[model samples]
Target chain A: MEKAIEVKDLRKSFKSAAVLKGVDFEVKRGEIFALLGSNGAGKTTIVKILATLLKPDGGTATVNGFDVAAHSENVRQSISLTGQFAAVDEILTGRENLIMIAKLRHLKNPRQVAADLLKRFGLVDAADRRASTYSGGMRRRLDIAMSLIGKPQLIFLDEPTTGLDPEARIEVWNVVKELANSGTTVFLTTQYLEEAEQLADQIAILHEGRIIVSGTLEELKKLFPPAKVEYVEKQPSLEELFLALIGKKEEK
Target chain B: METTKKHFLSDIGVMLGRSMRHITRSMDTIITVCITPIAMMLLFVYVLGGAIQAGTDNYVNYLLPGILLMAIASGIAYTAFRLFMDMQSGIFERFHSMPIARSAVLWGHVLTSLVSNAISVIVIILVALIMGFRSSAGIVSWLAVAGILALVTLALTWIAVIPGLTAKSIDGASAFSYPLIFLPFISSAFVPTDSMPTVVRAFAENQPVTSIVDAIRALLSNQPVGSEIWIALAWCLGILIVAYLLAMLVYKRKAL
Candidate 1:
């Protein structure tokens, strides 16, 4: 498989503190590669460098075969970054936000493109309302929709599900899965281990500005000793229970 | 190179549209921009008009140019505030990653400031007209007044960009405009510089605001602008070029 992102000995320092310490990793094209770590683990720094938003202090990163440092614009053209924040303009309506991105991308039919994305993202009902009125899930959906304007081959989701309720998180997960299934590469970072397990084709654990280990999920699991498989009856999770209870109360 | 240039213009257009929507939604920014200068204009024309003894009989005419400058200086604080909000909200990071030209984002805010400030200027002039202000200069000279105001707005808007990028707090982003708002008082905007103390007169005569105020006042009354027009142009252009370069430098550091 072709590599979508390749980084070697990436290094960055902010003043006296180093944020990325010679980190190295690679992500295959059309795969969801999750960089899992705790807070302050340099996941965002790595994403920023790969997205061409920040320059590394030392070493090299290439995305979609373009050197991030030397051919920053070429790298930028192939990638989209959904930052930790939703990054939507609060005063503009959801449709307006999509149109702005579409127009900026120089789409031939920006209005149609915006309308299509709104429908695909299930935001048509709220399309004309100011984005400030959007729930966290709606805002995240819009942010992802904006990133899809130019049909970039590679997308970065930096802590995309942070602070979201489980249902909203599942909605975003479904969108991400659909993107990958349709042949788009996704590089995701999250503090939650389950999020990585749920979405990543390959997983890398970042700690203290370094990738401690990285491999395909099966390969990573194989490194552990084999144990007897066991099964137990599963009850619905808390999230499912909460939804069921809420539905019952509303019906009554 | 051609595509980059093309993208730059279009990206600026899109960004301008986005910022203008914010302005339309929040009428408070426009209202605040006009209120401060209009209040000052009223105070000077009514209370301080007779005591100050400006050369002209109608203090509104004499003071209109100064108040207009104050309006512009105050107006650009919103530019900084808006830019600061974008930075805080992470939209700048999003824009940086896109294929669009980097400078286009700053140009968006700068152009928005220019348009909004121009509106505020026209509104102040209309209010002054109601208060018995008159201008005898022909259309060409009136165009000259507009040209100067545009230059002044461009220069100050670039200055505001620096704080908008570097400031840590909302107050810090906007507080830089206080000195700018006070600058007109020291100039010949309200009272003639010659009437001031020697040191004050020297400073007021040498400052950019005084040249701008004097040039506009001359053009409004059909008086010979003489060297003040050139001086005003030089000040405006000089500040504009320097601020643009500096703002770009800070922006590159912040964004990159």
Candidate 2:
């Protein structure tokens, strides 16, 4: 498999404080590679560097075979980024936002591209409504749709479902899954462990600005021991029962 | 849409549309921009008109140019403020990730400021015309006035983008424009610099505002502009080139 992204000793520091300290990682093409970290763990910083939004102070990164610094535009052409929060222009309608990005990307039929993305994202109904009026999920869907204007080979979604309700979060998850299933490489960063488990084919846990662990789910499960160890106890807490019933629907 | 060579121009159009939408939604900035110039025009014409010896037949026309400059200076501050908010909001970061040109972002806003300031200028001119201020200058001179104003507006806009991008707080982003708004008062706007103290006159006559105000006054009155038009264009172009280079440098280094 081809490497979709590669980072070597990437270091970024704001002032005297370091955010990314000699980090290294890689993502294979056509895989959903999830980055799991807490807030301020430099997950977003890494994403920014890979997306060419922020330049790393030290070390180098490449995306889709283009160096982020030397060949920035080529890297830019191969990737799309959806930030932690929806960056949709509230003043523009959902359809306009999509078409605007399409035009920016120099697509031949911008309106048609926008309409197709809107329909695929299940946003056809709210197409003409101003994005400010849309729900958080709708705006986020529009943001992702905008990212797809150029049909990027790689997509970076930084905490894409952070503020959504449960149902809306699932909607985003489904969209992400579909993108990966269609051969697009997705680099996702989220604080939710369940989200990583649901979406990631290759999981990497970042701690204190470094990837402490990276492996497939089953490999990680073997290293950490069973998250739920089976026991023959006669009683269990109500919280455990509730967790089993409602917390993870597909973990079983 | 054609050749991506003109991508910057189209980006300006899109940015103008978005910025106008924001301004229309929040009418406070436009209202504030209009209020300052109109209030100053009224105060200068009604209260200070008789006392200040401008030597011009119509003080409103003479004062109109100054007030228009003040309006433009004050108006672009909101552009800085809005851009600052968009920067803080991560919208800029989102745009940067795409294949769009970086310069287009600022141009979008600079053009927006130009358009909105033009409207404010028109409103102020209309109000002044209604109050016995008339310009007999031909269409060519009017076009010259527009060209100068556009250059001035673009220069200040590039200057404003620096503070907007570099400022940490909302107040900090907009605070730099306060001095620009007050710059007109010390120039030939309110009174001729030679009538003031030697030091004050030195500062006033040498600044960009004096040349700009004098050029506009000459254009409106159909008088010989002498060297003031060239001086004004030089000042505007100088500021524009320098500010654009600096703003781009500041932008290139920004963490966004």
Candidate 3:
């Protein structure tokens, strides 16, 4: 079978400045492939190309058998994108926002689909509430839920968990994993190294618009072996120790 | 084509609801659009009406149609501004990723502008009626006025969407609309084109504002409209088609 996503020598630039320089990568079907990069490393630019939002200055990409440039509408039909922020409309209710995307996608039974997604995202209780009123986690959930309206084969998540508590972030991780397990190819770009380690079946480190490294977790770990895994080795973690010392002194 | 049409109609209905919700939520914007034109009509009719040399009819009657068009022109900008906001917010990018129709987004915004402009026009007309502005035309004539206003709004809305998609700043998005707001002043909307210089008369008569206002004015007055109505519809339809094509072109080039 052909790769779910294929890119070769993809170069993107904003006028004089190049953002993505001859980047080559491919994502296997049903695999969670994470593109790790720092800010301005062209992570989002690559995601945009794959999602059919931005055209590369040079090189070409294909998503789910459709060329990103020549067959954009076809590529668009098979992929969904969730941007860095939870870009839901503030004035629209959670359900309205979902339904808007559903209707735009020409979904059959939009209301039912919206309800299912809402329930699936655990947002049914807040479905009627304006998305603005939602907590950060709820909004992000709704954002991801909106992307599923098309039943897309590939999902480009550009920083899916930028501003979430640890617990909420883990929930998103589970969701991404679940999507990959269910045969959806998840192409993710994230700043969090741990997130890549946790979720990615395959990984590529994009630095300065080039893929400096590409491998699995074990493969990546081999390059910088024994990079100081620091631990406190504390006497009862200090906080607990201090608390017990103070309590004993008080009792004495 | 059939699927596209189905998607378009569905998008229009859904977008019309969303746009109406936006207006209803902020209602102050619609009220401002509705009341500003009528207020100007009131001020012009009562304060400046006596000095104006529009025609033999009540000055209110002569100026009412212009104010109606102005109301629509002003109201339609908000639609563009709203579209701009959505574009900036990454909503269009989100829409593009879905499997639905591509043109639905633009149509949604265009139809919303038409609906809200309709409300603003009705409000202005109600105020005009209260202030002794009369129209003797029947339903067909009224429908003609509606058609003219809808086409005008559609054209202006498309024009507005261009900046909304391309502008770097919020104020920049709506800034382009200022020239549109000022257009009616130079045309026959406010004064008789015959009174202007020869050059200005040619411009004012040929530009869309004059023809549209004149067609609407003639329709409301129950006068034989002659070819002016055709010219007006042609201008409105022509501008609508051109602006729409240009906007979609520019919008396609724009990055989210």
Best by lDDT: 1
Off by over 4 Å in 1: A228-237, A246-252
DockQ of 2: 0.49
Best by DockQ: 1
Top model number, TM-score: 1
Candidate 2, residue A14: how far the Cα is off, in Å: 2.5
lDDT of 2 by residue, B15-98 (tens): 777788788877778888999889888889999888998887788988888898889988889888988988876678778877
Give stretches of model 3 more than 4 Å off: A226-252, B1-8, B193-206
Between candidates 1 and 3, the one scoring higher on lDDT is 1
Ordering by DockQ: 1, 2, 3
Q: Against the true two-chain complex, what DockQ does each candidate achieve?
A: 0.79, 0.49, 0.48
The CA lDDT at B8 in model 2 is 68
Query: Against the true structure, candidate 2 has what lDDT?
Result: 0.87
Between candidates 1 and 3, the TM-score winner: 1
| Structural similarity to truth (TM-score) of each candidate | 0.97, 0.91, 0.90
**TM-score (second chain) of model 1:** 0.98
TM-score of chain A of each: 0.94, 0.90, 0.88
lDDT of each: 0.93, 0.87, 0.83
Q: Tens-digit lDDT track for model 3 on B1-256?
A: 3454567677667766776788778889899888778878878888988888987567877887789877877787687688878887777778766555667777777777777888888887888888887778999999988887877888888888888778788788778777777788889987899999999889888888888888888999999898998998898788888988998898767743
> Whose DockQ is higher: candidate 1's or candidate 3's?
1
